[model samples]
Target: MAKWGEGDPRWIVEERADATNVNNWHWTERDATNWSSEKLKELLMGLWVEGEEGKCEITEVSKVE
Candidate 1:
């Protein structure tokens, strides 16, 4: 499985005019300001757990653009 926050390798930071490959799709990280609380919770749960006592806690969320 891919690591969280590292993003997908198929994602590009810039757009290509002659882009014709599915592996070269432009994907940028947009601001999460408009995300709902439920949406955030779902994402947090997707995190990898190490042990039985592993717990995920989200204390703060920052605005990204």
Candidate 2:
């Protein structure tokens, strides 16, 4: 192991006044609920499937949760 003050720089955590994540290395939280719901609805709606004498279509996506 390297000595206390001679360790690799990448392993060191820099001091910050706000104590935020350094270099965005940590996991950050984001709210995507509305965006994901809309995206799912857009992708699911208007889909159609046909096989032999059967056919089905997704005309509307009411909820995605």
Candidate 3:
């Protein structure tokens, strides 16, 4: 099983989660400018379960341009 840092854009399907330093994410890739942060924020914020409120962490994201 391999582990990825917070700077990583993807995670492997490992049996366990590994910890890594991400103080500097300069190695991280950038998405296209066509993507709208506001729209994405709105969509992610809509993950509420209504009657059953909960929070989720975004482990993955992508952009098409």
Candidate 4:
């Protein structure tokens, strides 16, 4: 662990008027729900499976939530 007032330089965030995450020490969140849903629907919509007896196909993706 780093001592008080003597933290590693790479882990320090520079002082600025806007306290942005320059060093990226703080966690950030991004909303990719819609994008992930759409990507899943696209990838799963036309998937198909075949067996010795029968075959199956995914014609539509109704919901991906």
Candidate 5:
């Protein structure tokens, strides 16, 4: 696996007052879903489980539909 922070700079989201929400977030590419599987996994490295009781890392992800 590749190291973290070793991808395109355009994917990086720097802090900005106006870009606080998802709607105003800046991006170099328009298609946000064009990321690779590895990139997607890396982006979601550490995450708490939703609709659960305790805190935990998200080991897997699946589509509901």
Candidate 6:
């Protein structure tokens, strides 16, 4: 949901991390350069979707992350 891929949507869903903590991740191009395609994409997804307040949080808890 972070809308990782730049040009299009891939429907690749992933888990969500702690909303208030970006402690371990280094969300930058350098860090992503070494990642596998899937891994890099996941990171990208993590970038924008992590903070969405209502879009993903409802009725049931998000199973992501």
lDDT of each: 0.59, 0.83, 0.50, 0.81, 0.59, 0.44
Ranking by lDDT: 2, 4, 5, 1, 3, 6
Could you tell me how far off, in angstroms, the CA of residue 28 lies in candidate 2 after the best superposition?
Answer: 2.1
Question: Compared with the true structure, what per-residue lDDT tens digits does model 6 show for residues 1-65?
Answer: 24445533564333467543244454423444434665655555534334545444223323334
Candidate 3 overall Cα lDDT vs. reference?
Answer: 0.50
1-65 per-residue lDDT for model 5 (tens digits): 33576766766555578656566444454554535655777767676675557677876755321
Report the Cα lDDT for residue 55, model 6: 43
Compared to the true structure, candidate 6 yields what TM-score? 0.19
Write one digit per residue (lDDT tens) for candidate 1, span 1-65: 55666778785544458665555354655666657655776676556546688866655555434
Candidate 3, residues 1-65, lDDT tens digits: the string is 33454444475333335434254333655674556765775577535443456555654345423
RMSD of each: 14.6, 6.2, 15.9, 6.5, 15.5, 21.9
Write one digit per residue (lDDT tens) for candidate 4, span 1-65. 76677888786455678877654568676899999999998898879999998989999888877
Native-vs-model 2 lDDT? Answer: 0.83
Residue clash pairs of candidate 3: none
Clashes by residue pair, model 1: none
* TM-score of every candidate: 0.21, 0.61, 0.21, 0.58, 0.26, 0.19
Worst 10-residue lDDT window for candidate 3 reads 12-21
Error of 2 at 25 (Å): 1.7
TM for candidate 4 is 0.58
lDDT, residue 59, model 5: 69
After best superposition, candidate 4 residue 50: deviation in angstroms? 0.2
For residues 1-65, could you state the per-residue lDDT of candidate 2 as single tens digits? Answer: 87768878887765579979866678676899999999888888888999999999999887787
Of the pair 5 and 6, which is ahead by TM-score?
5
Give the local distance difference test score of model 6: 0.44
| Best of the two (3, 6) by TM-score | 3
Predictions ranked by TM-score, top down? 2, 4, 5, 3, 1, 6
Task: Give me the displacement of residue 51 in model 3, in angstroms.
Answer: 15
